[model samples]
Target: MVELLNAPNIDQYAWGAINGCEAASLLEGLHCLGKLTNVNYGEFLKQMPIDEGGNPNYGFGGSPYKNQAGKFEAIFVKPLADWAANYTTYEDLSDSGVEPIYQSVEAGNPVVTYVTVHFEKPEIETYPFGDVAINNHAVLVDGVNATQVHLSDPIDGKYYLDKSKFEKIYLSRNMALALLK
Candidate 1:
């Protein structure tokens, strides 16, 4: 038996347009962990790791302007995990298979993963990594009951999606994931 849950109160638009969905989803996961363990996540998110770019930085952190590219999580996720270690440890689940993802979610932390900006709609472009479609949004995998995956979309809110659909978008974006333990 495996059961995991996260807070559904992630406000992806908390910082107006400065913070991206990825940052917001990370915030949601951290806040949920804080609630589960009684810690101060509010103070932490205000100073979380961020990409250094144009006005998008907006002091805290912001997404890159259109037409430009940057590895969003590479700029923060690992570092956030390192910083959060003061409270509890975390695991890097990037490029992992579905079973590991299931294990990660079963462990309590919702998997902070990516999906396409439009879910099924993506504009193919050649990035520094390779010629592939881009994942322009961030979401949390709250739980997995068999093949059904429950997720919280920072933009669309909470819902359960088909595993195949989730995998399609996730794998296409390189299966980027991080877990807090």
Candidate 2:
């Protein structure tokens, strides 16, 4: 199934008002799987851990919070998990992370994941968290075919990617993801 989340619109906390793409995908993924309902980016922003660094702490648009990649759990995933239905957050980072993602989708959980905004962007932007390209985006992985996972990108909308091509982007940023099951 294809899924999508509305990008944030707040300029200060996001690339725009829709800066919480990762959070957005998390909400949509869980909802699509019936693990959560009615949550959105505004809810994520409201629940995300707050700090003096504000937007950067949340790494809105892939920019680091005061140059730090905010804790994916505290700043993003866990809070959502607390609101979901019969699901717990389990991490499956690397170690063939792609397979676990597909497994989770098959087992009735979609992955809320991190990826570059675009597959072709160069890692040129500097941040205290680390150097990054423009679109450190968040998405939902709910369906898979033989070689690719179907995902919903908040900024780019819904699409599929070559499994190998998807891994290059996911692994680049530590294979960031949250699984709700």
Candidate 3:
């Protein structure tokens, strides 16, 4: 994350100017370019939102949405099912067990992985509300311990999730992205 926020010559390593598009549009175009195939993590942070003045939304790191970082996660993973047929082979996720699923390692392509993102409405939140209306956002799981999922809301920038507090959440979507490894 630090590297993407500070990297010089980032445009040379990847296309899509940071300020060029909203998260959804940027993800869609990159998926079309074939530059973002199954690869994960390596180039993702580059597409993160920058303020109109070309500054990182520093508040983001401290926001309640931090762990619940869905916009980016969903934007990254939404297009993979379309990109799958382009893969010469398919890998199964059932074997990944409790770990996040890992897939793809093709030359000139990004190694991508898929993970499910679960969310819940905010009516049940106990935290004090501020700039972000918790009711408007989804829950982001912050920890994974066997059958348990931990979540954080970036708006608070503090992780306050517990195993049982989030049953109100639902699976909003499945995410896919290229992995650095």
Question: Each model's TM-score, in the order given?
Answer: 0.71, 0.66, 0.26
State the lDDT of candidate 3 residue by residue for 81-101, as single tens digits. Answer: 233334323232223332342
Q: Candidate 3, 90: how far from true, in Å? A: 15
Candidate with best lDDT: 1
* Candidate 3 ranges with C-alpha deviation above 4 Å: 1-76, 79-142, 146-148, 164-168, 172-181
List lDDT for all candidates, in order.
Answer: 0.59, 0.54, 0.28
Off by over 4 Å in 1: 1-4, 35-45, 53-87, 127-135
* Positional deviation of residue 50's Cα in model 2 after best superposition, in angstroms: 2.6
lDDT of 3 at 25: 26
Please provide, for model 1 over 1-181, each residue's C-alpha lDDT reduced to its tens digit, 9 standing for 90 to 100. Answer: 3565855655555534333566566656766666334433344455555545422212223432223445432233455455445545567676675677777788787777766764786567654444544445667788888667887776677877878888877776654455565
lDDT of 2 by residue, 1-181 (tens): 4222221221224434335565566556656655446555565556544434433334332322233353221234333344432344555444455667776676666677667766754455664555554555667776777778777776666777888888777776544454654
lDDT pick, better of 2 and 3: 2
State the displacement of the C-alpha of residue 73, model 1, in Å, after optimal TM-score superposition: 10
TM-score of predicted structure 2: 0.66
Better of 1 and 3 by lDDT: 1
The candidate, 1 or 2, that scores higher on TM-score is 1
